[model samples]
Target: MKEITMPQTVRGVVAMAKGAPVTLENIVIPDPGPGEAVVAVQACGVCHTDLHYREGGINDEYPFLLGHEAAGVVESVGEGVTDVAPGDYVILNWRAVCGSCRACERGRPWYCFATHNATQKMTLEDGTELSPALGIGAFADKTLVAAGQCTKVDPAASPAAAGLLGCGVMAGLGAAINTGNVGRGDSVAVIGCGGVGAAAVAGARLAGAAKIIAIDLDPRKLEWATDLGATHTIDASTTDVVEAVQALTGGFGADVVIDAVGRPETWKQAFYARDLAGTVVLVGVPTPDMTLELPLIDVFGRGGSLKSSWYGDCLPSRDFPMLIDLYLQGRLDLDAFVTETIGIDGVEAAFARMHDGDVLRSVVTL
Candidate 1:
């Protein structure tokens, strides 16, 4: 017989109502059962996804527990959990692919149809179930997740920088290196130069892109993209995005164009911004109500790949530690993405800054 661990109470941020502000409340976390683990979250980045949850842009699920991009230490593990153990420094990832899924069995775990999350519920003190954002509610003192969601990374890395890779950063990097298949001397262009777009630019540079063109309406974000590795920038607010990209690429457009904004307009821009047979990778997150319509003839005329990147099609088990190593070696500038650090209570103000595009990432340090 095994001893049953009592439920522990911790402070967490919750969106109690749609279109309402998030509140700090007490929540109860159950003992990890069978394949779950509890993580004492050290640093959780305030991502745009968390803001979407508050605005009900993701779904109608209210009282949502937010925060996902995170890094922490494994505090405890449930029985039969062998992937990670206590005292291990880890980065929390939402994709915990089940081996039995068709996608996983096809040797494509990145597109795993079935992902695992904690079976046990982490509820409010009143016993109301709180839906965790992306199945990871790290905006708390602690969080419970399926053991597979915990990806162990180099402990020497800064939690604030390493945590961003848990989501946005990974999405951008994978968009270029994985989905886009950016090759040496390729001309790459990334649209919407926010955190994700900037990361895509860096990823392109890392992959030996000859020309990295960044397009965005905001000069601040464009400047950030330049710092990250963009060799050229297009101010979409004034200049024609497609024309500028073509001009930068010797009038042929880029070899690969990535849209990190996730809007129909930006996607269309990406669609038309690439050279013949070039690839377009849509890494940005689009809202539910948004619809995209393109001419059927144009779809055929454009002889290239149009793909959507979910979490940059990343496998945390493989990418996390390797990227962390690159960061430690100074080959990858993970630290540049972090704009500021704040306490958990400062999330709302951080959200305001994120809304105004005043910050890249306002990390919540526990």
Candidate 2:
């Protein structure tokens, strides 16, 4: 293929300082080297992690390219790459499991031995090196990442919807299917009706959960929860979540209670919202400063698993395509999660909306 004149700078949202606004500007993107692939991003969702990066919760890496939930088409491939090719519609995965670690050695390659990431550095127009969030940053028209990070999915699905499986949706689904092991006729309660919480509701429903109680303070999100398959909704602002869940589930409790909010209060609710010998799945990512205080006897008395889900135990190669297939079959309502779409320049404003719980997901389309 004849190489055209590559633009020396590509437009991106850059966080140059902590607790500052992200500014869109021309950034210098180097040619793909080694196992890297330059992806032409179609859509990237504004996640809490992006806001955390701006607030320095992730790291002190200034000039960070903030975004991870994304779907894109591969524009170019680098040396020794074969997993994906140019023109493939792919969802980016942060944990591109390395296949030789202790976890992988046990035949669980989903827990990879070593994960792949971008090998080349993307920089600013002024020659400052920019750290791409999670090594697969997609908050730009184009971003570079390891070929392993790309999981090709059904091209017909909307990018804004498909991209969500790259993060929050995957986390929530994984918590239910992967961690909680929610089964048919099982009763499940989710303590939070945000994107992840609602996703858990959907996943549990898909997994054959009979009674799914959606708990949240906001009425808008409760409506969204109902739309996404929550059989019942609990306004935590009006009633106690644990008591409400117990009342609904035969006066015992749900079989599984997932703490999508991840705070001490919500976690406590999850602990008491489940029946004895039931599961408690924590999918919410908590801040570093937050601490939990629970009785040790309760831990032993529960007689069930207390687990945390990471990225929904997502194996991109396995889960992404399967979820996309489900979406195409009309079984999974991935489209319902996309509340609105915006351009790259709208990411900062999208962050404000996310903070206010105004939308399920604000996707940035290039």
Stretches off by above 4 angstroms in model 1 are: 1-4
- What TM-score does each of the candidates earn? 0.98, 0.97
In candidate 2, what residue range of length 10 has the lowest lDDT sum? 1-10
RMSD of each: 1.3, 1.5
- The candidate that wins on TM-score is 1
Expressed as tens digits, the lDDT of each residue in 173-256 for candidate 2 is 889998899999999999998999989999999999999999999999999999999999999999988888989998999999
Whole-model lDDT for model 1 versus the true structure?
Answer: 0.93
Candidate 1 C-alpha error for residue 22, in Å: 0.8
